[model samples]
Structure formats: structure tokens, C-alpha cells
Target: MLSTNSTAVAEFQRKSAQAQAALEKVRGRGTAGNGATSAMVDAGGRLRDLTFAPTAAKWGDRIPALVLKASRAAEQDAIAQVQKITKPLTDDPRLRQTLAETKSLLSAEEPGKRRPRPKAEESEDAYFRNFSPHDPR
Candidate 1:
């Protein structure tokens, strides 16, 4: 049992270090308005830099929108990079199984599928009361 605990702790530390290293290497940049605006985001999706071209003023009221677009693109790029870096760890069977189990426990319904509401004749309290802690069905 002691060895198992130590091994788990060591694995956690190793993965944590790897994740930190991957994050440190992340650098995402995005541009919008035909290079009129650009944004750079770090691994944590924090804006690191923003710049606008001399003609950016020509965008008028649309300048904010352009900046937002650039920012979003930069964030997406950062997320993609992080995913790439963590692919190996995420692909591990143990991690996948844990994620699957957690998702199942949190949400019984699949994505984009809504559970049907109880009939109008049934009171909301009664519907909830019917749920048993031991039985999820």
C-alpha cells in the first residue's frame, strides 16, 4: 500500500511538471482585418500583446470587433497548442477512463440531448421525490 501511494504521488508530480513545461512553451498569435490588428495570447489564454496597424483607425466603429476576433483566434490557437502538448497524457487509458467516469457521473444525458420534462400532471416535488439515491435509472 505504501509503495502504491508513493507511485501515485510520483506519477502526479511527473505529470504536473510535464504540463507546466508544455504550458511554458505555448505561444499563440492571431491577426485580423488583413493584418490591421493582431493579438498574442499565452498558454493560459492571457493576452500578452496587442497591436494595431496605422490604418486600423479606418475600421471606425468596427475596430473593437476586429480586436475581439483577433483575440478569439489567438485563444483558439493557444488551446490547440495545449491540446497537442497534452495529447500523450490524455491518451493514457487511466486518464481516459477517469474522465469518462467523471463525465458519466456528472451528466447522464449525452451532449445536445435534453431529457424530457415530467408530465404536467406530475408535481415537480413528486418527480424529484421519485429519485432514489441507490438507483440512477
Candidate 2:
């Protein structure tokens, strides 16, 4: 029979491979300057595709700027995609750290940015009332 240590190692290796495979399925795109141009990339940081609006061609002289913007966007997009793809693995600290590192690199927007959090429906005191010893059973 295999030792517990070996089983754990085997499981870790399996999970790592699964995480990488899940990342491969994540496709991300970054659009710049109102989506006039965009870059597509997979979570692996490999460029996949690009898009340009008709007017974008006129900015050929600014290709370097455009490329930089698109790359940043692509990186951010990839990070987001990878996060979603690997949600299941996030319970593992090592996996979560790996994903967070990518997100830090992209400076991805805060998860709560778009929507303001709703006010607490119940206050702490009220929450305790439900289980408080002071309350009669």
C-alpha cells in the first residue's frame, strides 16, 4: 500500500496539473482606448489574437503605445479568466497565492469595484440576539 505521504504528493501533483489545464481554457482579451484595439491572450501569457477598429490603422505611428496598452489589458484579462477557471482550487493556499500573484501583476480592478456593497441587513447585536444566552430558548 502507498504511504500517506506519497498519496498526498500524488494528489498535489494531480491538482497542479488540473489547475494548469483549467487555466488553458481561460481566454482573456484586453481592449485599449475604448476598444479601438484589443489583444487576446490565454492565461498562459501567450498572445492569441488581436483586433483593431478601422480608425485604429491611422495610429500606426503610435503602435508602440497601442501595444503596451493592449498588453496590460491582456494581462488583466488573463488574470481574471484564470481566477474564474481556478476558483475550485483557490481553497489551497499555494494555488491561491499563484493566482493572486498574477492578479497583482495586472493590477486588476477590485472585485467589489463596480457595485457598492449593500448595507448590513442585520447589526452585530441583532445577530447575537438569535444565539445569545440572554435570550430564552
Candidate 3:
């Protein structure tokens, strides 16, 4: 019979290998304003590739801004990929912890990444409330 520690170790190793394989398959893609520039990153948040439209080359000094935009987009993409990959592992506590760590690492460093507030017409309560007109029997 295997010792408890050995069994645990074996399980951990198996899960780790599975995680690595899942990560290899996960990828993110980001695009700048109107696709002037774009970037792709792996689940580990490492840039895999980048592309720029012809108009992007016109901005010499603005390259930094464009790159930052692309990087932010790439980070968003990675988070989405991580979310999808973690959904199936949600039942495993250890795997959930790993996914939390991965999410922290993949968060965007740039400002204004937060989604804009919804307009007045988009209120959730407004949509969910029942509208009853006056009725006389």
C-alpha cells in the first residue's frame, strides 16, 4: 500500500501536469483602438505575438501609447482565457487556489481598464421589476 504522502504527491504531480497542458492550450488576443495594433499572449501572460496596422506606423512618438493599449488588451484576453480554463476546475479547492493566483498575475496594470458605468436606462432593478397597470374589475 502506498503511504498517504506518496499518494498526495502523485496526485499533485498529475494535476500539475494537467494544469501545464491546459495552460499551453489557453491563449489571449488583444487589439488596440479599431485594430490599429494587436497582441497575443499565452495563459502565463507572456506575449506570444503582435501585429500593427499600417496606420500604426505613423505614430512615431505615440508608439509607447499604442504598445500600452495592446498590452492592456492582451492582459484582458489572458484573464478571459484563464476564466474559461478554471471553470471546469472550480470543484477542486487546490486548483481554485491556483486559478486565483493566476488571475492576480494576469490582471491589467494600466488604468481605465475598468468598464464604464452603465447608462441610466441600463439599471438592473428597472429591468427586473414587474410593471402592473391599474385594473378595475
CA RMSD of all predictions = 11.5, 16.7, 19.5
TM-score of each prediction = 0.59, 0.51, 0.51
Arrange candidates by TM-score, descending. Answer: 1, 3, 2
- For candidate 1, lDDT tens digit of each residue in 7-104? 65567568879888889979899999998999999999999999999989999999999999999999999999999887767666655555566677
The candidate that wins on TM-score is 1
Off by over 4 Å in 3: 1-19, 92-137
The global C-alpha lDDT for each of the candidates, from Candidate 1 onward, is 0.84, 0.73, 0.72
Two-way TM-score contest, 1 vs 2, winner: 1
Model 1: lowest-lDDT 10 consecutive positions:
1-10
- Candidate 2 Cα errors over 4 Å, as ranges: 58-60, 80-137
Q: Write the per-residue lDDT of candidate 2 for residues 1-137, one digit (tens) a residue.
A: 23644555566678779888787687777877666788988887788888888878778778668877997889888888787766655566654455566568667677657644445745655676678677785
Residue 43 accuracy (lDDT) in model 1:
94
Q: Please provide, for model 3 over 46-130, each residue's C-alpha lDDT reduced to its tens digit, 9 standing for 90 to 100.
A: 8888888988877778877877889778978888877776665455655555556657667745564765667774586565464
Clashes of each: 0, 0, 0
Model 2, 38: alpha-carbon shift in Å? Answer: 0.7
